[model samples]
Target: MKTVEVQNLIEIGLDGAEVEVSDPQGTGDHFAATVVWSGFEDMSLIQQHQAVYKTLGDYLTREIHALQLKTSAK
Candidate 1:
């Protein structure tokens, strides 16, 4: 998937989240995303990552081969 599509998906899924997605290796399957959202305030690191994973759903392993995620509470 393209970076814009990834960013849009995350932004929509996380509501008011600020999302930035990039293809670091210029490979369509590998992506890096940074997401900032208030929902992560009290969540653990694993939970934070899980939230992103959940947002992507089936698209995770299928369309996206690998995702490097950075998440923070705003």
Candidate 2:
């Protein structure tokens, strides 16, 4: 995926939060994203993970094959 797309995915996923995604796989299907956000402060780990997956929409059902996520609160 293009850099902008990755950026947008982060933006949308994190609710316009600032984040950077790394695609070590060099494939759009698999990606590692570092999400830094204040909104995550009091959220549960499952909630945090859900937030990211939520942004992917139907991608989880069909589209992207896999995603390895790394999240943090900033």
Candidate 3:
């Protein structure tokens, strides 16, 4: 899971969300991302994470070994 690929997936799934992803451990499988989208405003912290997870779909635990997500509203 390259950073750009992850960013693209999130952006597309979240309806053009702004995402910044980094490979913290220099391993493509371990990533950290910060996402900003208007949809997050009414969602709780857990819900926010779930929304991102939904975007990633099956890639969450499979392709992406770990994702540290920080989500915020635009």
Candidate 4:
């Protein structure tokens, strides 16, 4: 998927989230996302990643072959 589509999916799933998606090798299936959301304030690193994964759902395993996620509290 395109980075813009990934960004939109994340933004829709996480209210007030800031999402940045990139293709590391110019391969659309491999992506890296930087997600910032206030909801992560009290969550663990794992939880933060889980939230992102949950939002992306099947896209992560189906459309996206690999994802490098950087998550933070905003």
The TM-scores, one per candidate, come to 0.96, 0.77, 0.94, 0.95
lDDT of 1 by residue, 1-74 (tens): 89998998888889999999999999898999999999999999999999999889999979999999999999
Deviation of model 3 at 37, angstroms: 0.5
Superposition TM-score, candidate 3 onto the true structure? 0.94
* Per-residue accuracy of model 4 over 11-48 as CA lDDT, tens digit each: 99999998999998888999999999999999999999
* Candidate with the greatest TM-score versus the true structure: 1
Cα deviation of 13, candidate 2, in Å: 4.0
Which pairs clash in model 2? none
lDDT string, candidate 2, 1-74, tens digits: 54456658668767757677666777766666777777878989888878878877886667567767766687
Per-residue lDDT tens digits for candidate 3, residues 1-74, read 79999998898899968899999998889999999999999999999999999988989878899999999998
Model 1, runs deviating above 4 Å = none
Query: What is candidate 2's TM-score against the reference?
Result: 0.77
Clashes of each: 0, 0, 0, 0
Candidate 1: residue 11 Cα off by (Å): 0.6
Question: What would you estimate as the lDDT of candidate 2?
Answer: 0.72
CA lDDT, every model vs. true structure: 0.94, 0.72, 0.92, 0.92
Candidate 4 ranges with C-alpha deviation above 4 Å = none
Cα error of candidate 4 at position 44, Å: 0.2
